[model samples]
Each structure stands twice: as structure tokens, then as C-alpha cells.
Target chain A: DAGVTQSPTHLIKTRGQHVTLRCSPISGHKSVSWYQQVLGQGPQFIFQYYEKEERGRGNFPDRFSARQFPNYSSELNVNALLLGDSALYLCASSLAGGRRNEQFFGPGTRLTVL
Target chain B: GESVGLHLPTLSVQEGDNSIINCAYSNSASDYFIWYKQESGKGPQFIIDIRSNMDKRQGQRVTVLLNKTVKHLSLQIAATQPGDSAVYFCAETWSNDYKLSFGAGTTVTVRA
Candidate 1:
């Protein structure tokens, strides 16, 4: 089976612009989560959706939002992007929402804010 | 505030040698601990995980040891190989929570 997959592996945006990244979870997975990874740092959780419902959210600002589809695919959107928003956006999928399930990650979309 | 942190920023080891990486977490309520390996330009891969009920867990050639008393966690790789070179991160989360808190990763470099 294929792992989690993401689209537009690379993106470049300008300050004050908006960008959207997409993720397709593994087959039979029900939960999808988004994380932002800065250079030299670990991934920071952004949002988690289970069964198409928002189950968790991280410390990110209002500019960041995400939603999951019925098929378990997810989209992460960033509005009014800032230079600080430049990072790799990762998507992970799991069988469920809680800690009992191990998450499988995607290759991630590298967002560069110019 | 709960947080997870690593003891070292980097570790260099020779091939066929053993490697150890350490992490410390401040959340005593966290019952699940996981280790992830991330290569450049890719997402993290699950290495191993342990629950608070157990002190140790092993997977393939890797081992994860947990010490709840000191809130410490360690990952040990036996006969490390060059393919093991990557940034390793330790994450913690409670059974009731949906989020996983990650620490600053430890970069492992295996030399041939």
C-alpha cells in the first residue's frame, strides 16, 4: 500500500499571499493531521481531523486552517503568509484520532515565502 | 507547560558501533512515547514507541528505554549502519490527547 501522499511538493509564495497544500491519506485511514517543520527543528502540530471532524488544534495563528474531506484527504491553507511561514508542511495519517494509532507521514510540501 | 527535549544536538558514530540518543519530557501525564527518524527533504518515519506501563521496547535492531521516574527516554541502535543517519525526534502524548508533542531532534551521523 502506498504511504500518505502530498501534492505540489514545492511552493513559493510572497508575503501577504495565500497558499494551499493538499494531502491524501493512506487507504482505510480515518484521521489526518498537519504539521509545520522549520529548518533544524522538529515538526510542530497544526491541526488534526478525525472522521472529517476537527479533533485537535495546535498553537498556530488564525492564518492557518485545515479541513478534512469524507475520503480522509486534507487541505492546509495559510493566509496572509509571512516569511516566518516558510517551512515544510507535513501531513500524517492514522487509523484513528488518539495516541493508540501510529501515524504515517507524507513527503511534505516545502513552502517558501519570499 | 509540557515539553520534550533532547540531550544532544548531534551524535557521530562509526559504522557497526552502537548508538544511543536521549530525550527528556516534562509531562508526567504523558503515557505514550514515540521515536521518529527524519531524513532530509522527507517526513519522519516511526522508529519505536513505548507506553508508561513498560520500561523497554524493542524493534528490529533498535531499542527504546523509558524511565518515568526521571522522565527520561532513550533510543539504542545495535550495530548502527550508514542508513541510520538522520535526525531523530522523541514525541510524547497522553492517551486522551490527540496531539503529539515533539522535541528538538538529535542528528545522527554514521561514518563508514
Candidate 2:
């Protein structure tokens, strides 16, 4: 079924630079979410979009944002990246009808901000 | 400021032994809870989930127990194998919405 796929399996950026990571959800999924996992910590929610509308957001700074395309794919953008921003950016997708449903995750993009 | 958290940072068990991983969540409004397994360089994969209405749910070789009284959650792995070694996390969702909060995660290592 192709599952979930993420782009730029790895990325290296300098501090203060902007970065964009992409994700393609599995077929028949309507909900997309973004999460950040710092080293030795669990993933923290960033944003969730359903039906192309923002459904939820975490406590991340305004510099972090995301949008889901009409096709259900999503992109996560970070502006003025900091060293702390160097973490795994994960994308998950699921059916939106069943109470948010069970999210299937992609391998994620390892972002390293130098 | 209350969030999902784990009791142990790491757990090591011999193969074929049963293992239990525990978590605590603060939000009483949390109606749905899930357990996810993550491997090195990969994202979290849903293992099993249980709702507040139920105290326990069982899947393949795993079981999830939820204790609303203590705001606690636990994942139990039966007859653990090396493949079962990974970081396990527990997450809770607010009843008013589906926003999820994950715990710090427990690393499970199965000894051969």
C-alpha cells in the first residue's frame, strides 16, 4: 500500500537557515501530522491537519509551520532554524473519521542544524 | 504543565521473559491512549491502543493496561524476543480533541 513516505531522508542546515521537509501519506488517508524528536526524547507533536484544515498544534514556536495539500500530502517548514531544531522530523497519516484513528508514520527526515 | 511520562529510562530482559513498561499521564480528560514502538533512525509505529472505557486490550504478543485512577498506562510484552527490543512510548489524547501527547519513552533491550 506504499505506506507513508518522507523526503530528504537526511538534511544538514546551518543555524538561522530555513528548511522544508515533505511527506506523502498512505493511500486513503485524510489526516496528516508532524512531530519532532530530539535525541533521547520522545516525539513531540507539532501540527496536525485534516481535510486541509489545521486541526491541532503543539507548543512549538511560530517559526515552525505546516500545511497539508489537497492531495493529503504535507510539508513542514522551519524558519530561522536553531541548533535545537536538529532533530528527526516525522510525518504520520491516518483516517480522520475514527476519532483521529491510528497514525502510520514515515521513516522521517533527520535534520541536523550545524 | 502535566504531560505523559515513563517510569523507567531503559529495561533489559532475557529472551522468552515477559516485560512490562509503565507510563503516567496527567490529563484526566484523556480518553484514548496508544503505545508506539520506535527503532533506531525510524519514526514511531503504533503497537496497540486502548480507550478509557476499557482497562485492558490485547494484541498479537502485546497487552496495554490503562489505570484511570492513577492516571497510569503500561505496555506488556510477552515472551520477549530480540526483535521486540526498541523504544516504547505511551501517548494520550484529550477527550475534547485528538491532540496527542507522548511520553519520554522506555528503551527495551532483549538479551539473547
Candidate 3:
């Protein structure tokens, strides 16, 4: 089976602009989560959606939001982007939303804010 | 306020030698731990995982040792090879929590 997949592997946006990144989870997976990885740093959790409901959220600002579809795909949106927002946006999927499941990650979308 | 952290920023070893990476976590409540390997321009790949109930778990060529008492975690690579060069991160999570707190990561370089 294919692993988690992401779209628009690379994106360039300007300050104050908005950008959307997409992710398609592995087949039979139910939970999807988003994380932001800055260069030279580990990934920071952003949002987690299970059964299309928000299950967990990280310390990110209100400018960041995400939603999951019925098919378990997800979209991460950043509004009024800042230079600090430039990083790799990663998506991970698990069989469920709890600690019992192991998450599989995608290649991630590289967002460059100019 | 709980977090995970690594002891060293980088480690260099000969291709035939063994590699050991260490991590410390502040959360005593954390029961699940995982180790990930990330290469340049790629997402983290799962290496191995161990739960608080267990002290050690071994994979193909990797071993994860968890010390719940010391709140420490370590990953050991046997007969390290060039393909093992990458950044390794340790993550912790509790039973009820869906989020994982990751450490800064340790970069390993294998010299042939």
C-alpha cells in the first residue's frame, strides 16, 4: 500500500498571503494530523482531526487551521502568512487518534514565504 | 511543560562501529515512545518504538531502550552503515493524548 501522500510538494507565497496544503491519508486510516517542521528543528504539532472533528491542537496561532474530509483526506490552511511561517508542512495518518496507533508521515509540502 | 530532548546535537562514527543516541523526556506521564529517522528534504521515518511497560525492543538492526525511572530513551544501531546517516528524533505521548512531543534530534554521520 502507498504511504501518506501530499500535494503541491513545493509552494511559494508572500507575506500576508494565504496558502493551502493538501494530504491524502493511507487507505483504511481514520485520523489525520498536521505538523510544521522548521529547518533544523523537529516537527511541531498543529492540528489533529479524527472522524472529521478536531481532536487536538498545538500552540500554533489562529492563522493556522485544518479540516478532514469524509474520505480521511485533510487540508491545512495558513492565513496572513509571515516569514516565520516558512517551513515544511507535514501530514501524518494513523489508524485512530490515540497513542495506541503509530502514525505514518508524508513527504511534506515545502512552504516558502517571501 | 513536558518536553523531549536529546543529549548531543551530532555524532560521528565509523561505518563498522556502533552508534548510540540518547534522549531525555520530562513527562513522567508519557507512556508511549517512538524513534524516527529523517533524511535531508524528507519527512521522518519510523525507526522503532517502545512503551513504558517494556524496557527494550529490538528491530532489524536497531534497538530502542526505555528507562522509565530515569525518563531516558536511547536508540542503538549495530554495525552502522552509511545509509544510516540521518537525524534521529525521539517522541513521547501519553495514553489519552493524540499529540506527540518531539525532541530536537541528533544528527548521525557514518564515515566509510
Candidate 4:
């Protein structure tokens, strides 16, 4: 079966613009999480959704938000993007929420903010 | 304000040799620890994981050792290959929490 999949592999936006990245979880998976990976750094958690409910959030600003659909797909939105927002946005999926569940990640969408 | 961190920023290992990467976490409440490998322009791939109840776990050619006393974690790659050249990260999390606190990552370069 295919792993997690993301759309718009690459995106370019201005400092004040908004961008949305999409992710489709693996079949049978019910949890999805978003992470932002800066160059030369490990991924930082942004948001996690399980069963279409917000389960957790990271230290990111209010400009970042995410929502999951009934099909286990998720969308990450960033508003009023800043140059610091330029990074790879990764989406991970697991069988369910909580511990002991292995998460599979997507290729990620590269967001470049100017 | 605890976080996971790596001992080294980079490592160079010769082919066929074993490689060891180390990480330290400050959160004693963290019960689940995971290792991930990430290549350029790609997302991280789960390598292995261990719970606080266990000290060691092994996968195909990879071993993860956790020492809760010192809050240290290590990943050992047997017979390192060129394909293993990438950045490795250690993440810590609680059993009930959904966020994964990740380390800075160690870059592994397999020499020819």
C-alpha cells in the first residue's frame, strides 16, 4: 500500500501571502500530524489530528493551523507567511493516535517565502 | 523546557564499519523514544523506537539503545553502507502526548 502522500511538492509565496499544503494518509490510517523542518534541522511538530479532531499542537505561532478530513486527509495552512516560514512541511500518518503507533511520512512540500 | 539533543553534529564512517550516534534527552517524563533517518529533500523515515521500560531494541541492521539513568540514547548501524549516509534524529515523547520533541540530528557520511 502507498504511504503518506502530499501535494504541490513545491510552493512559492510572498511574505504576507498565505499557503496551504495537503496530505493524504495511508489506507486505514486515522491519525495525521504536521511538522516543519528547517534546513539543517530536525522536524518540529506543528499539529496533530486524530479521527478528525485536534489532538495536539506545537510551539508554532497562531499563523499556523491544520485540519483533518473524514478520509484522514489533512491540510496545513500558514497565514501572513514570513521568510522564517520557508522550510519543508512534512505530513505523517499512523494507524491511530498516541504512543506505540509508528508514523509514516510523506516526501514533504518545500515552501519558499520571500 | 526540556529538549532532546545530539552529542555530535556529524560523523564519518567507513564502509563496512559500524556507526554509532548518540543523543541526550532532558525530559524524564518521556517514555517513548524514536529514531528517524532523513535524506536531502525528503521526509524523515522511522528507523526504530524504544520505550522507557526497555533498554534496547533492534531492527534490520540497526540497533537502538536507551539509558534512562543518564537520559541517553544511541543508534548503532552495523556494517554501515553508503545508503546509510543521511541525517539521523532522536525524538522523545510521552505515551499520552501527541507531540514529538526531536533532537538536532546527526549527519552520517559513509566513506568509500
Candidate 5:
């Protein structure tokens, strides 16, 4: 089966602009999560949705938000982007939304804010 | 302010040799730990995971050892190959949490 997939592999935005990234979870998966990875750093959790409900959120600013669809796909939106927002936005999926479940990740969408 | 962290920033291992990467976590409540491998321009791939109840777990040619007493974790790869070259990260989360906290990764380079 195909793994988690993300869209718009690359995106460029200006400061104060808004951007949206998309992700589709693996078939039969019910949980989707978003993470941001700065260059040379590990990924930082942003948001997690399970069964189409908000289950968890990270320490990111209010400018970052996410929602999951009935089909288990997800969209991550960033508003008023800043240069610090430039990084790879990753999406992961798992059979469940628990910490014990292993998460499979997507190739990620590279976002650059000028 | 406690978070997961790695002991070494990089490691170079000869082909066919064993490789070891270490990580330290400060959250005493963390019960689940996972190791991930990430290549250039790619997302992290889960390698293996071990619960606080277990001290060691093995999968394929990899072994994860956890020492709760010191809050230390290690990943060992047997007969390392070039394909194993990548940045390895250790993440932790407690039973009640839904997000995984990751550490600064250790870059592993396999020398031929």
C-alpha cells in the first residue's frame, strides 16, 4: 500500500503571506499529525488529529493551524508567515493516535518565506 | 525545559562494523521511546521503539537499548552499511501524551 503522501512538494511565500500544505494518510489510517523541521534540526510537533477531531497540539504559535477531513486527509495552514517559518512541513499517520503507535511520515513540503 | 538530546552530533563507522548512537531524555514520565532515520530531503522513518517496561528490543539488524535509571537510550546497528548513513533521532512521549518530542539527531556516516 502507498504510504503517507503530501502535496505541493515545494512552496515559496513572502512575509505576511499565507500558505497551505496538504497530506493524505495511508489507507485505513485514522490519525494524522503535522510537524515542522528546520534545517539541521529534528521535527517539532505542530498538531495531531484523530478521527477528524483535534487530539493534540504543540507549542507553535496561533498562526499555525490544521484540520483533518472525514477521509483522514489533513491541511496545515500558516498565516502571516515569517522568515523563521521557512522549513520543511511534514505529515505523519498511524493506525491510532496514541503515543505507543508508530507513525509513518511523508516526503514533506518545503516552505520558504522571504 | 527538559527535552530529549543526543550525546554525539556525528559518527563515522566502517562498513561491516557495528554502529552505536546515544540519546538522553530528561522527562522522567516518558514511557515510550522511538528511533528514526532521516535522509536528505526526506522525513523521518521509524526504525524501532521500546517501552519503559522493556530494557531492550531488536528488529532486523538494529537493537534499541533503554536505561531508565540514567534516562539514556541507544541504537545499535550490526554490520553497518552505506545505506544506513543518515541522521538518526530519538523521540519520547509519555502514556498520556499524543505528541512525540524529538531530539537533535545524530548523523551517522558509514565508511566503505
Candidate 6:
């Protein structure tokens, strides 16, 4: 079975620019979540979408947003990016939402903001 | 275990030796815990999970122990190998919010 897949493995952008990262969830998986991992840090949750609807959100600012499609693929959008946003953007998919959710993660897209 | 240095904590262990990495959680209400291993430029891979109901869970050569009385968690690997080298993170999940709060992570380097 194919694992979670993310697109645009790497990207570079300047401050105040916009970037969108894409993710395709595994087959038969309906829940998708986004996380940001800086160097030497753990993955920080951003947004979680289930059945094309957002189920939960983390402590990120308003500049970060995401949506899930009917096909279970998702996209993460960052507006007016900052250098601090330079990190590995990871996409994870689980069988369902709610408690005790075990997620399978993608390789992650490395985002560089200059 | 774990330390609060600017960099991730590093634990070097020789191959064929046993390894133990520890984590202290802040919340007492956390009922579920999970350990993940992340390699170079890769996302975390789930190692094992244990609930508060039990003090330990074993999978293959890996074992996870939880001490609710002290809010401590540890991962023990028997006969450690070079492939076990990675950043290990412990996460806690509460019943209220399904979000998993991750630790800073401990780097385990299995020396040959």
C-alpha cells in the first residue's frame, strides 16, 4: 500500500510571499493533519481536516490554513510567510478522527523562507 | 534520557547493548502515550504506544514503560542495533483534546 504522499518535496520563498503545500492521503484514509518540525524539535501540529472539514487546529497563527478535498488529499497554505516558517512541513493521515488517533506520516516538504 | 539543552539530547550506545531513553511529561491527566522514531530527513515512525491502564507494552525487541505516579515514560530496546539510531519522541494525548503533545525528543546513536 502507498503511504502518505506530499508534493513539492522542497521549496524556497521570500518573506511576505505565499506558498501552498500539497498532500495526498493514503487510500481508505479520511483524516489528514499538518505539522511543522524545525531543526532538533518535535513535530508541531497545525491543522487537521476530516471528511473535507477541519476537525482541529494547533497553536499556529492565522497565516496558516489548510483544507481537505473529497478525495482525502489536502493542501496547506501559508500567507505572508516569515523566516520562522522555514521548517519541514509534514502531512499525516489516520483512519479516523478523535481520541487515540495513530497517524502515518509523509516524507514531508522542506520549506525555506528567506 | 532527557535534557533541556539547546540541542536535542544525545545517547550513544554500543551495538548489542540495551538502551533506555526517558521522558517526563507535564500533565497528569494524559491517558495515552506514544513513541516515535525519526530518521534523517524523514517523518516520525511510530514505535509503540501504551495507555495509562497498563504500565508497560512490548513490541518485537522494543518496550515502552509508563510510570503514571511520576509522569514518566521510557523506551527500552534490547540488543540495540545501528538501525535504531534516530530521534525518539514521546507524546501524550488527553481525553479532552485528541491532540498529541510531543516532547523535545532524544537522539539515540547506536555505535558500531
Q: Residues B1-112, candidate 4, lDDT per residue (tens digit)?
A: 1112458899989899888899998799999999999998788999999999999999999989999999999999999999999999999998678888899999988889
lDDT of 5 at B40: 88
Per-candidate TM equals 0.96, 0.95, 0.95, 0.95, 0.96, 0.95
In model 5, residue pairs whose N, Cα or C atoms come closer than 3 Å (at least 3 residues apart or on different chains), thus clashing, are none
Candidate 2 lDDT: 0.89
Q: Which sequence of candidate numbers ranks them by DockQ, best first?
A: 5, 1, 4, 3, 6, 2
The iRMS of the candidates, in order, is 0.7, 1.9, 0.9, 1.0, 0.7, 1.1
Q: Looking at model 6, how many pairs of residues clash?
A: 0
Output DockQ, candidate 4: 0.74
TM-score of 1: 0.96
- Tell me the alpha-carbon RMSD of every candidate: 3.7, 3.8, 3.7, 3.7, 3.6, 2.6
- C-alpha displacement of A68 in model 3, angstroms? 0.6
When summed lDDT is taken over every stretch of 10 residues in candidate 4 chain A, the lowest stretch is A96-105
Q: Write down the lDDT of every candidate, Cα atoms only.
A: 0.92, 0.89, 0.91, 0.91, 0.93, 0.89
After superposing candidate 2 on the true structure, give the runs of residues whose Cα lies further than 4 Å from its correct spot. A97-99, B1-6
Which digits, one per residue and each the tens of the lDDT, describe model 4 over residues A5-96? 99999999999999999999999999999999999888999999999999999999999999999888999999999999999999999999
Alpha-carbon shift of residue A46 in model 4 (angstroms): 0.6
Candidate 5 Cα errors over 4 Å, as ranges: B1-6
User: For each predicted model, how many residue pairs clash, with residues at least 3 apart or on different chains?
Assistant: 0, 0, 0, 0, 0, 0
| Candidate 2 lDDT over residue span B1-112, tens digit each | 1112459888888899889999998799889999999998788999999999999999999889999999999888888999988999998886566567899889988889
- Tens digits of lDDT, candidate 5, B1-112: 1112458889988899888899998799999999999998888999999999999999999999999999999998998999999999999999788999999999988889
Model 2 per-residue lDDT tens digits across residues A1-114: 698999999999999999999999999999998999898998888999899999888899999999999999999999999999999999999988234488999999999999
Query: By DockQ, is 1 or 4 better?
Result: 1
